[model samples]
Each structure stands twice: as C-alpha cells, then as structure tokens.
Target chain A: MAAETKLFGKLKTAEQEHEDPKEQLMFDPRPREELNRMVMEMMTTTTKKFWLWAIGLGVGVVVLLFGAWGYMISTGMWVTGLRRPIFWGVFIVTFVFWIGISHAGTFVSAILRVFKAEFRRPFTRAAELMTTFGLAAGALYPLIHLGRVWVFYFMIPYPNARWLWVNFRSPLVWDLLAITTYLLSSTIYLYLPLVPDLAMARDRTTGIRHSAYKILALGWRGTEAEWFRLRKAIQIFAFAIIPVMFSVHTIVAWDFAVSQVAGWHSTIFGPYFIIGAILSGVSAVVTILYILRSTLKHMDYFLRPEHFDALGKLILVFSMAWAYFFFNDYLLGWYGGEAAVRQILTLHATGPAAWVWYLMLICNMAVPWLTLWNRKIRRTPWLMFIITLTINVGMFAERYTIVPLTLGHQRTPFDWGVYTPQPVEISIVLGTFCLFTFLYLITSRLIPMVPVWEVQEGQVAHTLRKIGKAEVPTVTELD
Target chain B: MAEVSIAEKWGLVVDQDRCTGCNACVVACSMENNVPFTGEDNVAFGRGTYWIYNKRMWEGEYPRVAPAFQPVMCQQCGSAPCEPVCPTFAAVHSEEEQINLQVYIRCIGTRYCANNCPYHARQFNFQDPDIPEPMNSYLNPDVTVRSKGVMEKCTFCVQRIVGGRQTASAEDRPLRDGEVTPACVAACPSGALVFGDLSDPNSRVSQMAQNERQYKLMDELGTKPKVTYLKGGGRNGG
Candidate 1:
C-alpha cells in the first residue's frame, strides 16, 4: 500500500494536463437559477466608476448631440461643412454607418437563430440591443440632415394641405419605410424574447425593480402553453425578420444605387451592402462579447474562448464574402470601362482618399483573413476584439468613402468639390456614438445581457458523446 | 386642376460662340428670382446660390491661356433625374410648361435631387441669405424668396411663363412664339441665349437647336435636357 501511494504520487507528477471538454460553455452547464442570480447581481451592483461613466456619457449626449443639433436648427446647416457637390456629408455617413452597425443585431439574433447556431444563444440579446440602439441613432440623422427638422413630417407619405405627397419612387422614401419597419420589428423582436426573462427577474426580485420587471414580463408564467406560444412566435420572428433585415440594408443600398453617381450606381450594391453589414455586425458582436466577458463577473463562464473561436470563423467567412462582392463590383466596372467609373475608381485607389480605401481593405479583408485563419488567434478574446474593432472602423471609413468621396465626383469637372466635416458635423457624429453607447450601457444592466432561457435551452440540447477514444460535444434537436 | 393641355415644349439654345462669359445673365436671374446674396466666405466654399452661373474652364499654358465659359442652369430634362429622386416631389417636372419647378414650400431639403443633378445646377440656401441694405427693397414681389435649407435652381423663370400664359389665355389666342423669354435669355448682352417653343419648328430656338453644332451636355446620360448648346468655333456658322 505504501509502494502504491508512492507510485500514485509519481504518476500524478508525470500526468499531462489535457483540457477537459467540460471547460466549454456547452459542456459545463450551470443551473438557470444560478445564471439568473449572477446576471441580477451584475445588473443591480453599480460601482462609483459605473455612475461616473454613465453620467459622463449622459453629459456628452446632452451637450454634443441635443445641444449641437438644436444650435444647428436655429443657426442653419451652414454650420455643417456641407457645401455644394458634397451636399450629403457626415450626417449621411453617420446614417449609413449606424444602419450598418444596426444590421449586426438582426443578422445574429434572427439569422443565426434561424440556423440554430448554438454559440449565438448567449450573445443574441447583445446583438439585438445593438440593432435597436444603432437604428435609434440612425433614425436621428435623417431628421438632423433635414434642412428644416420641424417639417420632417413632410417626408411622411400622407397627403398635406396642398395635396402634395411624398414620392414613393425616391429611394429615400423607401429607406424611411424600410428603416421604420426594421426599428419597430426589431424592438418587438428584442422585447418578445425578453418577456420570459423579465418574468424570472420579477419572481426573484422585490420593490420597484420587481414591479418594473413584473409589468414588463406581461404576466409570463412559463406555463407549457406559454412556452409553446413563445417558441412559435420566436420562430415566426426569426423567419420574418431575416427578409426584413435584408430589405432594410438593400433599401439603403438603393439610396445610392438609384442615383447615377458613378461609384454608387451599381447593381451589386444590394448584396454588397448585406455582406458588409454582416461583416461589421459580426465584428461588433465579438467586440461586445469580449467587453462583457472581461468586465462582468461570471460572464467568463457564459462566454468562453469557444464562442470567440466560432465568431472568428464567422467573421472570416464574411470578410471573404465582402472581398468577393467588392471584387465583383470592381470587375464589372473595370470591364465595362465606363469613363466616370474608371475615374472614380482611380480616385478611390490613388487619390487623397486612397488611404481610407486601403485601410478598409486591410481591416475588412486582410486582417480577418490573415489572423482568423489561425485557430489560436480566433480563440484569443482580446485579439479577436481588436480585429473586430478594426473592422468597425473599416466599415465606417467604407461608408464615408461611399457618400462623400463619391459625391465629390460629378460629370462636371468644373464643379467638382471635396467635403470635410465641420465642427457641428463632427460634434453631432460624436454625440450619436456616445448616445448609442450610453443607451446600450444602461440597457445592458436593465435586461439580462445573457439570455438565460435561451442559454438553458441550448444547454439542454448539447451533450457529450463518445467518438472513438474521445468525448465530443454533440447537440440534439431540443425543440 | 382641370387637365391644362399645353402645345409648347419650351426650349433654349445657347450659342457658345456668341457667349463672352460676361456673367450678366447670372446676375439678372438672381435678381429676377430674388436669389439671396451669399457671402464671399460661402462662395469660397462653392456654396454660392446662383441659379444660373457661368461654368468657366481655362485652357492652354499661362502665356497662351484662354478662358472658356458655358452657362449651366437646370436642364429641364424630359427624363429629369432630379425630378423622380426628390422625396418630397419639390423638384417636380411641370409637364404643362415643359419646365422643372422648385416648390420652396414643398422642399424638405433631403438634397437627394441636388446630388442626382449631374449639372450641379441646384444651389442650397445654407443660411438665411441677406440681400445687403437697400438691395432688399428691389426684391421681386412675384417671386417667393426662398428660405434657408431649401434648394433653388433655374426654374426657367416659371413666373414669366405663368404671366405670359395668363395674358395669352385672356386674349383667347395661342401663346406668342417667344412669349416667355427667361430672365437669363432676355438679359444676355451678346444674344447668346435664345428661348422659344420647340413645337413651333419655325421658332428661332428650334432652328438653332437643329444646327449641326448643337449638342446637349452629358447627352449620353439620357437626361435628354430641353436646353441644347450650339458648339462654338465649328465650321458651321452660329
């Protein structure tokens, strides 16, 4: 027995550290009750730093966004750097960029959910919230971009006193309809799935917070019939929202495509925009996931390296898709040899804005392809975050290039002019960014960031199965 | 609101050969239409709100340089790109007069029409324009002074067309051949611009439009502008 003990000690010393499969989120499951408590604790607990950051962001929104916009309203659009030829400047750019960012949430929450992507379970709400906030920020720009924000209702299709009506032929009108539809649908999409979780919070909490959750929960008792209806409704939303998501970006693409602008008037813009949306969306999700994991307590367990690795692969795929569509657009234009198109392409490639174009290529195409091809890099949270962050910057630069750069190019060389955002434009753009972040920060605390029910559902379906000498993670059809 | 049928397809012929680039027509249109005076700072940024302006280009080296000018205004295209893209239909194509109209009150100022305009003819009032002291007294009562954030372009002087049409209608006769000469055409010192009904083939503008040298700017784009330019320095005499 003494010899056996000594031998066991020697074996323990020599044992190789094999990573257990249970370390993965799916393999290592915690009870839903524990997850709810963890999320509630994180939500309820606020450090001084949190309040300071929120207040600072709130001040920024008030001063930069609302204050500047009010000033612009009274002072005039001249305060913006929107001159002739570059009539649509940073406001349009911000509008498009936020729309692109908004695309990420619907894409993940609806598309991934439709496909039954298991890694999507924990982060769908994070993505959906982005859709809501990004769109809220996006919707502001058209109003802000309007020369008279007061008469913004004129864009509404209803007949006016003079019997004048909005032109449905205009892509801008289509953009309005599509974006409004998306905003409404996505908000409902966001809130519908959140009902059960709110109910859980209602039962577990007390006082004002409990009452708030109870009202929000809509009497969700999680009964068999309720669960059945919730699943069916979510399924319907998952299917219906996918096309709406596609249409929203496609309609936005039409805003440019319908125009005769050499760079913008391309048939490929629809799909090209969709591909770009997914790339930016996935990048945003990864970045948000990284932040949640690092900052929130117990989030490390919910968001594992496995999730990062999966998202990295998805981002890589989308990056390749973006490159493909981009090339397709280029090849068609190049082959057609349209003089205006050639001139614009030359300008984009080698002009003063060439740096932006190159950065877009590197960030959206080069970085994702090069680094994401490595499994280790994909699994690294911080590295993936940096990559995604770079992608977002690249996407923003892409929108800027599309709007202002292309607007600079017209058939009349004599009238050709460039745009640079003035202080008002810059301030408003910064304000919108701060506003989106501020709303998101406050929301992340209110709603369960990790969809506990969805996560629990996923955990029920996922199991370990023997494959040869190893135990591999397998997912059964839960529904 | 009754169907007001119009026989005249009004058109313009710019004889570039006769145009010396005096920019008087620009001033005339601005005055006639009550276009606000944009400051020099706005002009430097290319935000000048001139309805009709000379598009000048310099050719050859400094010693041998010659300045060329082409007065560009709203093309009044039959298939106007700007007309269909306006979200508010503010930039509407008037089928009755065959002119492009800018309804200031209807304008929400999305600037989509301005961007769609290949000629860059449209000008947005970036700020409340001030006609310097005493000049405001001469502002045309017939024309509505545009507010800030509204886009204004050469309307082919729609007020003149309305007045001419009213006079013709009262007299119970078809409109005269050159009943409505826009401010720019009337003000041209060199007789470079001609305006008339294209439906009347005998009209001077129609004959000039058929000249071998006559060409439409960006014709390949299919905007099919009603205004035609008689090419200068060609074998065919203007």
Candidate 2:
C-alpha cells in the first residue's frame, strides 16, 4: 500500500507540472450569487466603445448587405460578377461559410452535452448563439442571390393560385427544409438552458428589463419539477439536434454533389462538408470566446486558458480531419480519370486562383498542425484567436474553390471562363458578416451571455479530493 | 385526328462540314426569338443572350492553326440534366411536343439549371432588353420579350411549330415533315442545319441522324441529346 501510494503521488505531481487543477473553471468554484451577479453585470454593462462598434456594424449591414442587395435586385444580376459558367460566385461562397459557422453552436452545446464533457459548461450559450445568428446570416444568401427576390417564395411549397408545387427532387428544396429545421431546433436548444438564467435576471432587475426577463424565463421558480423538466427537455433536444445539425451541412453539400459539375459530383461530399462545417464552426467558437474574454467584463473568470486549451485540442483534431477529406477529395478526383475532373483539379493547383487553394491548405491544414499541438500555444488566447480566424478564412477559400472555381472550368474548353467578384458581391458579403456580429452584439446585451445556472450546477458537481499527497479534481454526473 | 395521334418528337441535325461559320443562323434565331442584344461590354462579359452561338475551336499551333466553328443551341435532351434540378419546374419537358420547355413566368432564376446544362446553352437576361425605339418595332409578336432576371434559351422555334400545327389542323391535313423548321434551319445559307420530326423514321432529320459522321456532343453523358452533329473534317480530317 505504501509503494502504491508513492507511485500515485509521482503520477499526480507529473500531471500538476502541466496545469494546476484549481485554474479549471469547474474546480475554481465561486459562490452562486457572485457568479450570477458577474454574468448580470456583463449583460447590463454598456460603454461608449460598445455603442460605437454596434452602430458601425449596423451601418455596414444597412449599406453593404441590404443596400447592395436591393441595388443588385433592382438593377439586375448584371451588377454582380456572376456571368456565364461561373453562375454561383461570392454570394454562394459566403452563404456556405455562414452555414458552416452556424454548425459550431449545435456541435459545442449539444454534442459536448451528450458526451458529458465537463469543460463545456460556461461557453455553450455563446456557441449556441453562433448557430442561431450564423443561420440567420446564412439563410439570407439563398434569397439575396436569387434573380428575383420578390418571387423567392416560389421555392416554398404552398397552396398557391398557380397550383404548382416546388420541385421536391431539387437539392435547393432539401436545403430549405434542412436549414429551416436546424434553425428552429437550434434556437430552442439555445433557449432551454437560458430559461433558468433569465429567471435569475428577472429576480434582480426592475422595470423593462425585469418584465422582459420574466416573460423570457417563462415564470421559472426553479422548483424541483421545473429543473427536472428543463433538464429532460434539454436532454431530448441535445440528442435530437445532433442529427439535424449534421443533416443541415450534408444537405448543403448535396447542393454541389447532386450537380453534374465535374469536381463537385462526388459521393464523399456529404461527410466532407459536414467535417468542414464542424471545423469552421468550432474554430469560430474559439474566435468568439477570445473576443468575449477580451472585451466583456468579468469574462476571464468563466473563459480561462483551460477552456482555450481544450478547444484548441478539438480544433487541431478537426483540422487534421479536414486535411484528410481535402486529400481524399483531391486524390479521388485525380484518380477518377474523368478528363474534366482532372482538368479542374490541375486548374485549381496551377490556375489564376491557385493562391486561394494554397491559402486553404496553409491556413486550414498547416497552421493548426504546426501551432495547435503545442500546449502553450493552445492555452495562449490571442494566438488561438489568430489561428481560429485563419482557419475560417481557409474555410471561406475552400467554399470559393468548390463553388465558383470549379464552375469556371468544365468539359468544354471554348466555354471555360474565370470569375472576378464585383463590388456589389463584396459589399453584400461584408454586410452579412456585419449582420452576424450586430445580432450577436444586441443579443449579448439582451440576455445573460454566460449561462449562470449551468456554471453553478457544474461547480456543485465538481470537487477536489485529497488522494495520497495530491488533490485530484473529479466531476460527478449531475444529470 | 390520325396525324395528331403521334407526338412530333422534333429533332435537329447540324452538318458541320457545310457550316461556313458566318453566324447567319445565330442572327436569324435571335431575330425570330426576339433575343435581346446586350451591349459590347456585357457581351464580352459572357452575358450575351444569344439563343445560339458558334463555339470556335482553334486547332494546332501558329502556322498550322485553323478555326472550327460549331453552332450550339439547346439540344432539347430527351432526359435533360437541367429539368430535374429546377426548383420551380421552370424547366419542364413538353409531352405534347416531345421537347424541353422553359416557362418564363415560373423561373425564379436559381441558375441551377444553367449550371447543370453540359452544353451551356442556356442564357440569362442580366439586364432588361435595351432595344432602341425603332428597333423595338422589329421584335417578334409571337415571342415574349424576356425581362431581366429570367433564363432563356433556344425553344426549337416552338412558336413556329405551334403555328404550323394550327395551320395544318385548320386545313384538315397532316403537317408536312419540312413545314415546321426552326429559324436557324430556315436561315442556314449552306443548308447546314436540318429540322424535322424524328418520330417518323423516314423524316429527313432521321435519315441524316444515321450518317456515319453524325455524333452528339458529350453523348457519353447519357443526356440523350436530340441534336446530332456530322463531323467537320474537310480541311484537317478531324
């Protein structure tokens, strides 16, 4: 028994050399009231700087996204760089990027919850917010890219005077159904855990804020039955939404896969796109976490280096997975022996837009592989932020290469063309980015950015016990 | 009544050897179909609304170079890739005429159909038709002048086919095989283009479709294109 205890002591000291268990959010517990107050303060606190940024983003959305979209719609598709062959361009690329970003929320919240990862307590709400707003930003592109935005509803299946139904066989219809289902489900998933926090805010605030929280909280008294039902509802949605999230990106992939486009027609696209979505989505979560930590009040307590370290590990895994798919896609196309596919693959590497392809590789594959594996780098907030931001840029390049670049080259050499995005497309793309940030900014103030109740629950379940000569942190299954 | 029992199953045959690359067929089809001529910049930008355009291919290097022009229009494939992908059923196969049709009013312009078309035959109306005052009078009365934000393509001179059928029905006689030629075939100076009912095995298009040199573009794709091209090899034996 003495020898066994000594062996355990040595192992514990080795583990302690890397990280003090007390630095982890779960082990570093604060009083319930203090935690709640901190979150409420973050929500209520407003500065001139915040207003300036919000107003700036709002102006960007108005002019770049909506104004440009309206001008393009009224003037015609000619205003955009979309021409023959390159029918889908920057609009579609950014659309896919937003959808990919949205996947982060459901993945971090639902998947991590289902897996019972203790590190996911504080930042799940932040990630889930991305899913909702990312979708809002993404869902707009399908309409904005349309030739006639007025008749956009024609794609929706309804009993119309024309007595015609949308073609169910088309992948676009599937995309409409899938994205709608995902958005509704993910919003509900984000709200379920938020209810208890809202109830907490309701008890403390007055006037309009109190009334708003009261309604949003659904009159939660935090009774035993209410807690049980809330947990059960979240549990159900947690499992149910995983498939919905996967389906959303998979269907998005089918939009390209089901086409006869040379490089796009592949069976592997469904899983490849889903993996790509998760990579971008999870990287986005890290980016958002870094922003929140730096800007928001008292965020350093909830979002720690441990959380960044954990997310960095996830991003690294996803980056490797993305690389695997990228190579798999490339090799298969090269080996497929289809002349058009071969030509397209060559064009991607050596063509005018080869820089985009190289950027995709360097950012998506090389950066994460080189930097994220280091424990210090993973824990470094600003460095992880830069890496995650780079990954998203890489992801945007991936989508650009898949949509417009592939479309530009095909079987017929005479019809081959290159696409240069016009100013209108660039403005609209920037606008969606602003719209996402603006929505997030408004939502951050309106609701508890951190789920206070969840953090407290995790703290209650986590305990450090003395084992041999060292204290070891352990988590109890609260659910 | 007996003549109307069988669908026409219209087909076109292009004799590439006879085509002089003069673009007369392109001009005639544009005029007959009322296709808007986008300005020079727009045309250079690949926004030209030509229902038919000759794809010019350059063979060999500098001194040995020769340009071969292949006039490509909508093939009206029997099983078109564009039809199934269209969200609004804007691209539909006409059972009566046994050809593919684009319903202008139904198109929401997703451009998925254009992307799927192997021939790249479809054209989008990027801007409103800019026919100068006097030129507008020459626009065909039978065809609809498409506005911006809609997809248009060669309809196989569908209006002419309908008119020919009406005339034959009024006369109480079967429509002649050569009676309903598309504007392209009618205007071909070298008689390079032939249009007829392929449902009749003895039709001129059916006879030409069996020639040894006849081949469809990208036929291996199994789109089952209705248009056939006789190989052009008079100069280079290609």
Candidate 3:
C-alpha cells in the first residue's frame, strides 16, 4: 500500500510541472448545454446588491441627465457657463470624449478579425456591444450640445413649409452623416455575428427571453447555407465597416480640422483622431474584459492569460502610436510659430485646467508605458482593470483639454469664459453608463456573451502536433 | 440624370475683393432653401447651418491680426468624390445641369458618400426638428423633411433651379443667363458672389473664372469644383 501511494504521489509531482489538460478549456470540452447553463446562470443570478446599485445609478442619471437638460433647454445655453471665446465648452468636450470611446469594438472585432487574431473570438461580442451602445451615447452629446433638443429635427433635410434644407457644405453636417452611418453599420455588424448566439439563446430560453432572442436571431439555424450566407454577409460588412469606422471619427475630427481656426487646421487630424479613438476604445475594452474575467463566475476558462497578453500587446502598440501623433500635432503647431497657435498651446499646458492636459500625457502616454509593458501586470485582471480605468480618465482629460480648454484661449481674451457642464449634462452622461452596463448585463444572460460556436470553430481549426518531440500548436485553414 | 462632359461643366466664381460681408446672402439662403436656424447653443459651437459659410481669418496678433471674411460653399467638383462612393445611387452628380443633387426620397443615409467628400460638405439628420407651435406652417413644401438616418447636402438650391426653369419656360423666352440666381448671389450687396453660366463665354461667371486672382479651395485635392473664389485682395491677411 505504501509503494502504491508513493507511485501516485510521484505521478502527481510530475503532473504538477505540466498544466492539466482538463483545466485548459480547448483540451477539455464541456457539453454545450453545460457552458450555456453557466452563461444563463450569470444572467439570471442578479442579487439585491445589483438592484441597489442599479437604482442608485438610475436615480442619479434621472436627476442629472433629464432634469438638468430640461433646465438647459428652458433657460438658454448661457446656463451652462459657455461664452464666446470658450464657445465649445464641456458639451463638445464630452462629444469628442464619447467618440474616442466608440472606437474600441470595431478595432477589436474588425481589424483583429481581418488579421485572424484568435484571442479576439471570445470577447469580440463584449467589445461589439461597446461599439453600438457607445456610439449611441456619443451621438447624443452633439444634440445635447444643441441645447434646444426639441427643434433637433431642423438638422434633417426634410422639405415642408420651413424653407431650410440641410446644407451638405458644413463639417457639422458631415459629422451628422458619418456618425449616423457608423452607428447603424456598426449596430448591424454587431448584430450579424450575434445571430448564432441569439439562436443558441433562443433554443435554451423560454417566455419573453425566448421570443426576444428568436426575433433578433432572424430565425437562424446552424445549417451550412445559413452559415454560408451569414459568413458572406459578415465578410462584406467586416471590410465595409472598417472604412466607415475610420471615416466617422475622421469626420468628427473634421468638425475642427477643416477650419480656418488656428490649431484646428491640420491635414493630420483625420488619422490622428482615428488612432486616438482606437487607443482609448481598446483601453475601455481592456477594462471591461478585466472586470468580466474577475467578477463573473466561470469566466476564467473563457478569458485566459493568453487573451490578456494579446490585448496588452495591442494596448502597448496603440499607446506608442498615440504618443507619436500627439507629438507630431504638437511639434507642427509649435514650429509654425503662429501667435494664435502659441496662445492655444500655452492654454493647454499652463491654463487653469492644465493638470488635465498633463494628466492626459501621464495617463495616456506615461501610465500605459509604465505598467502595460510587463506581461505579468498585463495578465493580471485586477491590475489591468485599474490601468484601463486610469487610461479612460486620462483620455477624457485629453478631450476636455482639446475642446473647452483650448477654446478658453481664443484671439479675443474679452470673450473668454471657463466651461462647466450642467447637472443635466452630467446626469445624461451617467445614464449612458447605466444604459451601456445594463444592456451588457441583460445581453449576457440572453445571449452567450462569449461566442461559443466561434470558440469551438477556433478549437476545431487548432490542433497540437508532435513536432521535434514537442507538442506544437498548429492551425488549419478551415476558413 | 446623365454624366455631363467636363468641357460643358457649370460653375460659379465669387469676387471676394468686392464682398462687403453684408450677411444678406446668409439670410437669403436660409429663406429660399428652408435652411434651419441654429439654436443659441449651436451658435456657440459654431455649428449653425449654412450652405455658404463665411470664414474670417486673422493674420497678425492681438492688435495687428485683422479678421478677413471669406465666403465659402460647396465647390461642386467635376471629379465629385461624394458621387461614386455611394453604395446606393442616392448621392449623384447631376450630369444634365452640372449640379450635385441630394435625393432625400431615395437616400438610405449610409454616409459613405459623405466621408469620401474631400470638401467636408454633408449633413445628417440626427433628430427630427420640432418647429414651435404653429411654426410648422412656415416650412417650405418644396423641400422634403429628412427622416432620421439619411445624408443631406447643398444641391446649389436645386428647387430654385427648377422654379427658375419653370418660370422661364412659361415666360415664352429662352432662359436669360442671369435670370436664375442662387440666394447667395442675389443677396450679395457688394456683388462678392457672382453667379451665372460658366458654359456661356459672355456670362460674368465665365469671365470671373478666367481672372488671374481666381482660386479653388484645397485645389490640390483634385475635386475640379464649380465654385470659384477671387484671391484675398485685402489687409485681413496681408
């Protein structure tokens, strides 16, 4: 009996040196039903704690968003502290701010998908969810910035007694068109991949959830033709959506770029905004992934270290790219030696909100540079979460600096005024957060937030082979 | 309706040297074409609707840089980028009249056309505008109300062209070259914006386009636009 025990103990010691295949999700396949159940449980298992947070956020959003907005509409824009020189104020800052956040999903899903990045498969849905809801939230700031939300229709090109036709000549108009296209196409792009998961949910769910999934699933079945049609559609959209995504942010930048306004006029603003959007957006995804992997049960197997490692690498690259663009923009303006440009530059770094400008650098450039480079830190879900949160704060500060902060320093000092967003503006922005998280949570239960079929598909394409006495992972060209 | 040859292209030439910045054209374009008045907040953001935006650039410093007003509009380029990129045949360059036409009835608002437009001229209806009580009656019936999710841009006031054509045809005479005037052209008190047929050698626009001072905005982009501007002739920059 002692001999047998020693043999078993010896076996355990050796096995400890190697990872257990059963814990490796790819090596240990669960019954499809079991994985579905876990996802379902996470959805339905909301605690009193959840309700408390939701209600608290909801009340906060209501008071801040709707109430303050109502006040802004009734009283003029003067209520928000916006004046001539600092005309753009917090509203435009928030507009550009949310716009940067909107870039993550497309970069994660489309750009990564185009390159066949494997780790993207599981959390692409989570990222895509950010694209749709994030865009929705981002689009609202322009209208909210409008102050008179009711007469918002006047922006449309509709004909009637009012002789106003939409002037296509303005960048503001382009901002409208580009964002609308992006919001819709991204929504469609997001939904196209989600159909199968919706079908899976449709099969497992009952009552309202079943029908909700059914309608959204578009009567999908996993037949070869269904897959074929779906794949073709996705491929088309995947290629098509990238340019639209790039254009949307570019046009948003053009809202400033294509102007005689000093500091606004630059050829690089198009690519600059595009890169900025992707950088901040990916950081948001990183934060979300970290939260999900840590807070949710059974998410560890789906969200592994390898995924975080891949994301960390991307974050690092994007951080460098952002710094390059930031320096390029700064160098050109500084080199030009234009007096107006100098004033704007001075205001950005030395003004009352100068800390935000500096924090923009430390957070966007410094923090990511400092920590995300380490694989250990990148792979730590909790640490990465804090980093991503900090990145977002830094990015928001960047937008704040660009819009109101820069606006604070204009040609005429007499017209200068500091910007402060109204409580309504604050609330609505909060509501958007509540709305995004609420949608994500609800979707988690209804649809497998992780696209199981895609994961399975990847597994099918991947195999371990004996190459030179080593089990080297190889991928097949099933696609 | 059909692609007109570049040789027969229509365009406008504005003499900025003569412009007084009267803003009459701004109000006129809004009046004739149903352009919406931007609310107080949008004004602060510098996002008011204007088919023709007046740009003022300062040259020197606090005491020296003088603000010079330059009126700008869609340069309806011959190689129109906004035309071919549209997935649906919604935004098309007008071949018959050489004007870019925005078909509100057909546009799906995919906005691909807008992005490709180098001139940065295209607007989308983010929300349906609500005219105040009884203010709805003031809306022009000629223009279509843009539903949500569709692109819109200046058509060089196409409805006016149609109206002008109809009136001319009814008058029992070939349409006079100067008879059909766009709002900006008509309202220019200093005659800064001169609108006429570039196809006719005798017209003022054709002559203006030939001037040494005439230039196009972002000429390097190769839009081959119809709108032309006489070079800045004043102390605003110099």
Q: Give each prediction's DockQ, rounded to 2 decimals.
A: 0.81, 0.83, 0.04
Model 2: clashing residue pairs?
none
Candidate closest to the true structure, highest TM-score: 2
Candidate that scores best on lDDT: 2
TM-score of each: 0.95, 0.96, 0.66
| DockQ-superior candidate, 1 or 3 | 1
Model no. 1, DockQ: 0.81
The regions of model 3 sitting more than 4 angstroms off are A1-28, A159-163, A465-472, B1-238
| Candidate 3 root-mean-square deviation in Å | 9.6
Query: Which candidate do you rate higher for TM-score, 2 or 3?
Result: 2
lDDT of 2 at A78: 96
| Model 3 chain B poorest ten-residue lDDT run | B1-10
Please rank every candidate by lDDT, starting with the best: 2, 1, 3
lDDT tens digits by residue: candidate 3, A402-441: 7777655654453345767655556666766766676565
Docking class of 1: high
| Model 2 TM-score relative to the real fold | 0.96
Score chain B of each candidate by TM-score.
0.93, 0.95, 0.86
Question: Where does candidate 2 chain B have its weakest 10-residue lDDT segment?
Answer: B1-10
First chain TM-score in every candidate?
A: 0.94, 0.95, 0.91
Alpha-carbon RMSD, each predicted model: 4.5, 4.3, 9.6
